[model samples]
Target: MARTKVALVGIGKIALDQHVPAIAASPDWELAATVSRKGTVAGVSAYTDFASFLAERPDVPVVSLCLPPVPRFDYAEAALKAGRHAMLEKPPGATLAEVHTLQALARDRGLTLYATWHSRMAHAVAPAKAWLADRAIRKVHITWREDVRKWHPGQDWVFEPGGMGVFDPGINALSILTEILPDPVHLTRARLEFPANRQTPIAAQLTFSGNVTADFDWRQEGPQTWDIDVDTDAGRLALRMGGNVLEIDGQPMAGENTIMGEYPALYARMAQLVRAGESEVDLSPMVHVADALTLGERVTTVAFDF
Candidate 1:
């Protein structure tokens, strides 16, 4: 069997640590090449610009973009037109409109365009969704607080205009919620905490239509917490470690309790989409972020220095 050639664009931290390794491990994918301005994976043929990458590896039929949201549009658009399927990282584009445009373009070109949401694909997430599918959800509380400095390190684009700061992490919770919940959720109110020296918020409190509220903070200390608690008619469900661990009514569920395996599942889903000759692009998470931004009131807080 010939593995599908996959070119990883923007070989940055995420690419090096997760995406590249996932592709290498998958039997269905072959790491063909890389496109990046300053980053590269070891032993992989690298090109600085897209023009050169396309010129050299025209046989590469799939491109996984691990780049930031701001410039994702141009690269994805170009890849689709060049007859390559694209698998995009979370928060697919800087704005919802651009992602929609890419979706339409990919569909028209008869290409597979996947907006990969890594969080929703976590081990315990699908089970949680199944557990809650028939139950009536009363409320959900998501506490997604983390130490950005430790996790993100020197990535400065996180504080820029399209960076979306705390919401960058917050969107993960939204993705999981949108997947598990039976009905759609809309943001009712939001209070964003912005550092005096930054353009985006470092912390946020958001309320959705169904009594679902999330607290997102990037300045957390000690152990990081990425948890979601769902109150439903069946029982109380809890997801810890960003949906890698699950608890039902305070009893931890057996099996499917693991981590570092989400990326492989994401790649598998992308491959399935390619083989099926279809595209799966969900805009719920991004739409929630955009709604929060539009209705959110910014509050300037203590300035943070990275």
Candidate 2:
């Protein structure tokens, strides 16, 4: 079997920390080239721009886009048109419309396009979904507080209009929520808080209902918490540390795995899609974010200093 030759574009923090390592560890993929302005991966051929990289390495079968959402769609569309499988990091594109466009192009070209949700690959997520399969959900509470300065550091793109701000981490919670919920959910109400100097919201609160009520909050302070609790008729279920750990009724749940292996799992899924000749481009999570933006009330804006 031949390994998929993969190139990476926009090699930034995530590309370095997660995507590159995962690609290196995957047997199905070979890191053939990289495109970035300032950084380069260890031994791979590097280019300052995607066009040059694509032109120079016509044999690379796949391209993983690690760019910020603001400038993602065009590059991804180009890769798909070039007959390469394209993998989007998260929040696929700046707008839902662009993602829809990419999906159509990929489908028409018979290419694999994966808009990956890394959080859904967390260790305990599948188990949680199975545990809740026969149960009824009554309510859900998600507290996803992280110090942006610590996690994102000097990345200013996250605060830009298309950067997604709080939704950057909040979407992970929504991903897990969407997977575990027995039925489809619709947003009922939302509140977005934007810094006076920023275009994106720094914090948000949302309510989702599908025979269950969900509350999602993103804060930038305190203990750096990422937790999701579900109140069900059977018992209260809690997922901590981005679904790497699970608890039920204050007792540790069995069969929980905390491998910190999201990127590796993502590669495996992408390989599966390539072999199966299919695309996994679920836009529900992004749609929920757009719905929050479109329908959520903007209460107030405050000053946010990096």
Candidate 3:
């Protein structure tokens, strides 16, 4: 079978670590080209400028954007405008308004626009949702803590405006929460702790409708944590290791213990969407982050430096 050609934009850490491997292993996609200032995949065509890539690579019908949230809209806009199916990484865009604009443009142009949530594709996430769908959700508590230094290292863009700080990882938990719950939830109260030197918060505490709450922090020194525990009328459910591990009522269930499968699943879904001529833009998780930013109380924390 001939695979569809895809141009991977923003060949940074994530592109190298996840996207490239996923594309390499997939039967449906070929990494035809890449657009990045300083990164490239060996043996693949590379261009530093997006406009040149778009103009030269007319045969590539799909463009997957792994760029950071701030500059992502322009690339996605250009891709859709150039008659390419667009796929976005998590959070999709820095603002909800820009993503909505992209959606409209894609619809008008009859192109596929996928605002992907990789965490929702975690191996256990679907099973968790299935288990919860028939049960009654009493409460949900999400604790997403990680050492930014380990994950992001020297990436200062994470502390800049639109970087989303702790919410960057926190939104993953929200994505899974929004996916698994039987009913929708909205943020009610939030407390955000901002570093004295940063434009985004370093930690956040969020309370939502329907007894859902979250605590997100980026200052852990040792083993990182990404776990969500839910209390239901039937039993207790837990998803640890960023939704890769599942447990029910203190008994561990069967699932993958790593997040290695998420991007592959995402790419597969994107292929299906392209084939079906459909767009999947679920902004529920991003909406929760926006609400936390708007309604959250601000607190200044000690200055942090990498």
- Pick by lDDT: which candidate is best? 3
Give residue 77's lDDT in candidate 3 (0 to 100): 96
To one decimal, what is the Cα RMSD in angstroms of model 1 from the true structure? Answer: 1.0
The sequence of per-residue lDDT tens digits that candidate 1 reaches over residues 116-203 is: 8999988889888889889998989999999989878888889999999999999998999999888888999999999999988999
Q: How far out, in Å, is residue 128 in model 3?
A: 0.5
Candidate 2 C-alpha error for residue 14, in Å: 0.8
lDDT of 2 by residue, 96-122 (tens): 899999999999999999999999988
Q: Rank the candidates by lDDT, best first.
A: 3, 1, 2
Off-target runs (Cα >4 Å) in candidate 3 are none
Give all candidate RMSDs, comma-separated. Answer: 1.0, 1.6, 0.7
Clash totals, every prediction: 0, 1, 0
Model 3 alpha-carbon miss at residue 258, Å: 0.6
lDDT of each: 0.91, 0.86, 0.95
Task: Estimate the overall C-alpha local distance difference test score of candidate 2.
Answer: 0.86
Q: What's the lDDT of the predicted structure labeled candidate 1? A: 0.91
Residue 22 miss distance in model 1 (angstroms)? 0.6
Better model by lDDT: candidate 1 vs candidate 3: 3
